[model samples]
Target chain A: MTIPVSITVNGRRYDREVEPRLLLVHFIRDVLGLTGTKVGCDTSQCGSCTILLDGVSAKACTCLAVQADGASVTTIEGLAGDSELHPLQESFWNKHGLQCGYCTPGMILASHELLRCNADPSAEEIRHGLEGNMCRCTGYQNIVRAVRDAAETMQGGTS
Target chain B: MFAPQFDYYRASSVAEAAALLEQHPDSKVLAGGHSLIPVLKLRLAAPSALIDIGRIDGIRGIREEAGRIVIGALTTHAEIAASATLQSGATALSEAAGMIGDPAVRNRGTIGGNVAHADPASDLPAVLRCLGAEFSIAGSSGTRTVDAADFFEGLMTTAVEEHEILTSISLPSGSGGQGSAYAKFSHPASRYAVIGAAASVAVADGVCSAASVALGGLVPAPVRAEAVEDALVGKALSAGAIADAARCVGDSLDDDEVLGDVYASAEYRSAVAHVWVGRALTAAAARCG
Candidate 1:
């Protein structure tokens, strides 16, 4: 059976009918064509499918599309404005946070959620916050640095 | 991997969710979906209906009431890890929550879902058991409470009936200089506990008045080391005494009961269990002192 789902993504509303078995990741990637949200491990082990669900980062792969009906979601593509990049996006690029860029979107989204609630997270706090997201390349040092750099910029500090 | 076809219902309230579950025998409650979705994707579980309770109100908060900490079933691990109340009153729980399946799983997974799933490898069950938490369940009949010890029946099994939905968990207020800690050796791949220990100690005048030790990922269900707890009472809160009591965890396990998988061996898990128990005991005792 198909269930009607109305979700707001990146400030735009999408109304559609979806299968109960369709994963939120699939819905975002295939239905909405927001392919920035990559699916790494279909299991919840990997953070590549991370997205902001109602302001909190969640694994899109584990969530059913029908579960997200009437909810608000934010993908990595939503992080940038028409002409400028989000501070975290800029920091990731400047700090060499991405090597393959496969995990970048998820990492960025997760970091966005972390920095939203915690503007000034300590190193340990940042590490703990990003534990759910995984990056095989760059050894995570640069990613941590990117988040720290972004946090500084968000606090109105010069980069 | 495509999940099997099923009817979906987004319940507006807990009562509606319970009614849906009661109406469909093959229906399953979808919380964080960290546990249920994987099984569905793997075709291990084929529920005919999925009642999504993620949208239900009043099932997602961490509150303190009447000297007890009440965590709603929908309270995510991130919420628990970030909760000041949990950090102050139930530090072990917060620590365990921080350690569950890395950051993404923690962000998406819920405490009630973890406890309801009743996986022996889950860190929350052992820690909550050590804290003497009570689980609240709601059904078509009514609501009922079950102690943590009684809530976990076996591997991947809980006291929750098929028609019942776990609503929340309540942890007792620590009193009389009580302190607690949780220690676990996680499998690097899955982050599930290879062997985990949660310890709570109540000290009075530099002596241990009472202690509870719970073990997980070493058996089919979380095990309370009653023998070790008995050995610690009246003993001076010292490192040596803690070590002795921790070592008694091995005696509580049967030769066939120790967990073994690709990540670890039975003997290794038993050894790690002893080490983790000692660490948890020492840390908890330090807090007590």
Candidate 2:
């Protein structure tokens, strides 16, 4: 059975008839062709498929398209504007936050949600916030530095 | 992995949900879809239909009523962790909620779904049992309440019948005076509790007047540490007394009930249950001010 769903992705609204079984991650990656949000572990453990569901960080792989119906979702692709990079992206780039880059998009989006909730989080809090998103290659030091730098940049300070 | 195909029904109200469940006996109620979706994707549970009750109105808030703190079933872990009222009155529950998975999982996982899922490794059930909470269930017949002790049946089983929906969980309002804490040793990878101990102690004039301890991950379901509770009550809230009580944390359980796996042997889980209960009780007692 297919369910009709209208979801606003990033800023644009996309209405589609999705099978009841189609996961939100697949809907965004396969159907919508927004591949910025990588699927790391298809299981719920890895947060590479993390996205902002209605402005809250959630695992897209664990959510169904039907469950996200009428909801607003923000993915890694939504972080940047037309020309400029989002503060998180810029800070990550400046700080060399990624090694393999597979976990960068998810790390950036997860950090975005973290900074939104807590604009000035301590190192421990940032680590706690990004617990869901795993980076196998970066060893997390640079990612933590990137998040700290992003927090500083987002708060009107230079890193 | 993708979820198996199933008919989806969005119920506008609890009655509608119950009716839908009645009509489709093989239907599963989808709340946040954090737990259900994963199971569905694994093809472990392929219900014929899904009754989506994620947007139900009355089952989604934290409020005080009749000297009891009532948390709607649909309240997500994020909501519970962020609830100031819960933090003040039910600190153990709030702390436990915060410890489940991570921010992303907490944002999407609901208390009702967690309690109903009854995963032995889940953190909330043990904390709820320690808090002496009660569940308000909605079914076709009528609404009924069940104590947390009776609500859990066995591995991934709950007292909630197939047709019933867990509407809300209520705890006594004066839970703050009875300070509580949840000490958990979880698996590093999945963050599921390897052994968690939730402790609550009502201190009167530096004496432990009442005590309750519940354990998860050491058994098939969350079990109350009755022996630990018995050892602590009416004793001085001292390190010695707590140490004595901690020894009885899981003493009542049979060896077969203490599960063993590659992560933790039954003996290891049993031993840590004592240590964790001790730490949780010490922390809880220290907060009783």
Candidate 3:
């Protein structure tokens, strides 16, 4: 059976009929064609499918498309504004937070949540907050640095 | 790694959820989808339908009411962790909730689903048992309340039947001279507990008046460390006294009941239980008065 779902992504609402068993991550990637959100681990353990569901960070791989009906989703594609990069993206780029870059989108989005809740987080707090997302490359030192830099930049401090 | 084909029904209210449960005998109530989704993906459980109650309105939040902390069913682990009332009153629960499966998992995993699924390694079951929490279950007929002692039956088992929906959980709010803590030896990769201990200590005039200690993760169900509790009830909660009491944790655990996996052997987990229990009691004692 298929269910009708209307999810607003990046402030644009898209209505579709998805198979009841189809995952929200698949719908965002396949149906919506927003491939910035990668599926890593497919299980909820890896946060590569992390997205903002109703302004809160959640694992999209764990959520079914039907479950996301009427919800507002913000994927990595939604991070930038017009031509400028989101402060998190800019910080990641400037800090060389990615070597393989597979975990960057989810890392950035999860960091965005941490910064949204906490305007200025310490290095340890950033590492702890981004524990959900995993990066096989960079050994997480630069990821921590990137999130720290993003927090500073987002908080009106020069980074 | 995808959930098998199953019909999805979004329930509007608790009453409707209960009705759906009655109608779809093979259906599972989907809350935050933390526990259930993983189970579904692993093909461990394939229900005919998934009644998505994640969006139910009135069944999510923590409320301080009449010396009790009442937590609605759909309250996420992150919500419980961030609950200022729970933080101040029910320290063990909030602390344990905060430590479950990192940040993103906590954001979406609900306490009700955690308890209902009753994963042996889950954190809340032990903490709830330590706090003497009560569970409210709604059925087609009416709602019934079950104490924490009676709620968890065994591994992956709970008192919630097929026709019932867990609605809320309640426990006494923290008071002066009383405190709680949860200590766990977590597996590195998955972060699931190897041995989780939750302790609640009540002290009066520099002496321990009461104590409730429970352990999970390595056992099939939350086992009460009654001997540990008895030893502490009349002691001064001294380091030596706490250590002595922590040793009694072995009395409550049977050799046959301990769980062994690739990460830790049964003997290893049994050996670690006393350590984590002692740590939990020490932390709880420090927080007490």
Q: For each candidate, what's the DockQ?
A: 0.77, 0.88, 0.85
Best by lDDT: 3
Please give the range of 10 consecutive residues that has the lowest summed lDDT in model 3 chain B: B1-10
DockQ of 1: 0.77
Ranking by DockQ: 2, 3, 1
Candidates ranked, most accurate by TM-score first: 3, 2, 1
Residue-by-residue lDDT tens digits, candidate 3, B247-278: 99888999999999988999999887888999
Give the CA lDDT, 0 to 100, for residue B204 in model 3: 96
**In model 3, what are the clashing residue pairs, if there are any?**
none
Which scores better on TM-score, 1 or 2? Answer: 2
Q: Report the candidate with higher DockQ, 1 versus 3.
A: 3
Clashing residue pairs in candidate 2 (N, C-alpha, C atoms within 3 angstroms): none
The TM-score obtained for chain B by all candidates, in the order given, is 0.97, 0.98, 0.99
The lDDT-based order of candidates, best leading, equals 3, 2, 1
Using TM-score as the measure, name the better of candidate 1 and candidate 3. Answer: 3
Per-residue lDDT for A40-94 in model 1, tens only? 9888777899998888888899988887888899999898999999999999999
How accurately is candidate 2 docked according to DockQ? 0.88
Q: Report the CAPRI category for model 3.
A: high
Instruction: Tell me how candidate 2 scores on lDDT.
Output: 0.90
Alpha carbon lDDT of residue B147, candidate 1? 94
- Better by DockQ, candidate 3 or 2: 2
Model 3 ranges off by over 4 Å: none
